[model samples]
Target: LTFDDCNKSDRAFVAGVLRKHGFGATFYVTEGLGFLRNKENYVTWEEIVELDRMGFEIGNHTRTHPHMPGLSPGEMRKELLHIEKRCKEHGIQKPTTFCYPGFGHSLSCVRELQRLNYLFARRGVGPEFKDGGRGGRGPAYDPGVDHPLLVPTTGYAGPDWKMKDLMWAVDQAREGRIAVLCYHGVPAREHPWVNCNPEDFRKHMDYLGEKNCTVISMSDLSLFVDPRKGPEDPYAPIRARMKREK
Candidate 1:
């Protein structure tokens, strides 16, 4: 999945490309940075509605995209809950997944998200969440990490970057491990650090398709290990069967 800042033009362009390829993604909305909400540098509410109508999941990023680790617990609550309320007002129900601003969060942030009943609370895919090592410094590719919650994503920085590291992720997906590729832009024209052009994205998507894998929302991934199940699953048989089918 990817997020475009207050770039309405970028939103439409990227969404169009994903739809063209029959792939869906999530756009984590930052309320305060919205186009109509913030006329300076972000996408408009109408653009968000347009993408929502197109079957892309609209998730909560935050009100201002502040670093959660920097906020007090109450402030973090406001950032998480207020944006959630705003999403519902815009007709987005159960906005359960959140992308931490700059991958910043504290345990208090986790409590706040859980209090709000978020199902998928995650940072980027990386070693910190994976093997308990820290994630990437910038958007550099670091293969094979462990944590699902702090899912370390190999930023496909356009087509060239796609050629370099997108395969590592696709390989994991084929092995039944969830591969979450996070990106900053569809065309890495502005932010080369975590940007990727559409052609590269298409090639990457094509690779996933070739693996006979399904592209799913974070919600689908959450169902894999429902906290309520508490490790020893009462539903393991059913899930295992489904996995085998896949």
Candidate 2:
């Protein structure tokens, strides 16, 4: 399971819940807002450091959480670099995984992320790069079959998500496939679009425990992913085809 946005209150809340069950999650931090405390009840740099010490994986969610598709290559690079720098300054380990801000990404940014040595990047459920835009939910992730940069999530856990939806996604995880679940906040109203009620959140965690699901951090999943595989650019072949016609 993965939590995004790095909410301050959720930090302790989530950690307590997971620790009780002996599970851990990857908290995707946006250091720009975190350092500035721009979001109400957002985690501070010190708290982020504490999260790491508590045995949770702190993954990068960019510096400012910009709409990735709209960022120029330079801006995108800065987003990752700045967060990496901030995390390092606070003695946090350099994050090897990234979660797309607002579930948004540009195909161009994929190569840049690879250049930066990010082990993997997560996107919401969808056929990756569909119609040249990003979006997709998954049945389960087979690392050998999925692109490293465009890893598919099972789905987002928000007001619209029912327990059945989560159970279905978890059921998809058997046979060496991974179910990557995304959540924003617990009792999350700060960002209504991605909020999950605390009670509902517990139920999901309890379910995982009851079923004996192997909850893992993104970096844990990275061990099985082959970075050298997949299209360097999904469009590369298309671009080559165009060149031939030209």
Query: What TM-score, to 2 decimals, does candidate 1 have?
Result: 0.74
Candidate 1 stretches with Cα past 4 Å from truth are: 2-10, 32-41, 125-149, 154-160, 188-190, 223-246
Q: Native-vs-model 1 lDDT? A: 0.58
Off by over 4 Å in 2: 32-35, 38-40, 127-139, 232-246
Please, what are the lDDT tens digits per residue for candidate 2 over residues 173-197? Answer: 8777788888877866566756777
| Predicted structure 2, TM vs. truth | 0.86
| Top-TM-score candidate index | 2
TM-score for each candidate, following the candidate numbering = 0.74, 0.86
RMSD of each: 7.6, 5.0
Question: Each prediction's Cα lDDT score?
Answer: 0.58, 0.76
lDDT of 1 by residue, 92-200 (tens): 7657777887666556776677677776655653322231222122122212223233443544343345354666556555344556666655654434555556666
Best by lDDT: 2
